[model samples]
Target: MIRLPASIRAACVLAVVSALAACANRAPTQFYTLLAPAEATPVPAESGYAIELLPVVVPEQVDVPQLVLRSGSGALQPVDTRRWAAPLGEELRTALSARLSARLGVRDVYRLASPASLPLYRVRVRVGRFDSVPADYALLDAGWSVERRDDRSVRTCDARYREDVGAGIDALVAGHQQALARLADDIAATLRRFDAGGCPDTRT
Candidate 1:
C-alpha cells in the first residue's frame, strides 16, 4: 500500500460519506398499488334479460397509458416505477366488468372484440378529466352516451364525481371506481327506460 497524504485521505473519506448521504436522501422508487373502492356493491338484475357491456370506446382525449398522480404541491407523478400499460382501455374494461358484475347478476361483459352476437346494449364514454385535486381528493368528469343495437338515437349523459382519500395513486384509483359506478348506474337506468318502452325506436 502506498502512503497517502492526510488531506487526500480526509477528502476521500468525505467523498465516500457524501455519496452515501446522497443515496440516503433520495426517495426509493415508488410503485403503483390499487386500493379497492369501499362503496362497491353488486347490482341485482332488475330485468330477467341479461346485458353485456360492449367494448368501451375510450376517446383519444382520455387515452393515456398511465394514470398520472399529482402531488399536493401540483407535481405530476407516475403510477408505477415501471412504465404503465398502454391505452388504459383494458383497465377501464376490467373495472366496469367488476362493477357491473357486482351490481347486476351478470358477468358477461366483454371487450368490443368479443365474438358475441347477443342483444346487448353498448356504452360509449368520453372521459374529459381524471385527475387528483387539491385537498387530498380525486376528480373525474365524463360525458357518456348509450345506444341499443341497430338504433340511431343515443341517450347522452354527463356527470362529475369525486373521491376523498389520502394522496397518491390510491386516491385516483378509488375515484375512478366511484365515477365508473355512477356511470354504470346512469347507463342502467337508461337501459331500463328503453326496455320499458316496448322496444320503441327512440333513436335520437
Candidate 2:
C-alpha cells in the first residue's frame, strides 16, 4: 500500500473541506419576470396600422441581470439571491409589448424586430429610474416618444409611478408589475388619441 506524506494528506483534507464549505455557502438564486395584465376584453383584429416598439432602455444603475434595490440612503444594491429571468431591458420591452397589444386591441405590435413595411407609429421608451426599497416602495420613472412614420411628427411623454412594497420579495415584484401596468395604460390612451387623429399639442 502507498501512503501519502503528512503534508500531502493535510492538503488533501483541506481541499475537501474547502469544497464542501463552498457548496454549503452557495445560495440558490431566484429569478423573477414582469407579467402582463389580464385581458378583460378580447383583442380585436389588426387596425391596418402596426406599431413598432423599440428596445427598452434602462439606466445603467439598474441595468444588470440581478435585481437592484435602492437603500434608504439612496445607495443601489444588487440582490444576489434575486435576479431577473432575462436582461431587465428585454423583459421590460416584452412586458410593455404584451400590455400595449392587449390595451390597444391590436395584433401587430412589434418589438426589437419589425416587419418589412413601415409601421404607422414608432414607440421608444427610456427608463430613467427603476428600483425598490424594502418595505417602502417600488418606483418607475420613464420617458417615451411616439412618432408618426408618415408625417414624422412626434409626441413625447414622461411618467413617474410608485407602488408600495409590502412584506416580501413577492410584494416588491408585484409593486413593479402594477407600476408598469399603469404606465402602459397611459401610453395606450395616448396611442388611442393618435389613432383618432387628435394629437395633443407638444408641451413647452
The most accurate candidate by lDDT is 2
What are the lDDT scores of the predictions, listed in order?
A: 0.53, 0.74
- Tell how far residue 167 is off in model 1, in angstroms: 3.1
- Candidate 2 has an lDDT of 0.74
Report the lDDT of model 1 for residue 106: 54
Model 2: weakest 10-residue lDDT segment is: 195-204
The superposed Cα distance between candidate 1 and the true structure at residue 4, in angstroms, equals 56
Clash pairs, model 1 backbone: 42-102, 42-103, 43-102, 43-103, 43-104, 55-112, 153-203, 153-204
Q: Write the per-residue lDDT of candidate 2 for residues 19-128, one digit (tens) a residue.
A: 43465458577799987547678876655566878899999988898877665446666766678898999898888888888777655446345454745788899999
lDDT of 1 by residue, 62-99 (tens): 35554455544444533333223435566665666565
* Model 2 pairs whose backbones collide: none
Off by over 4 Å in 2: 1-26, 37-40, 108-119, 195-204
As a TM-score, model 2 comes out at: 0.78
Best by TM-score: 2
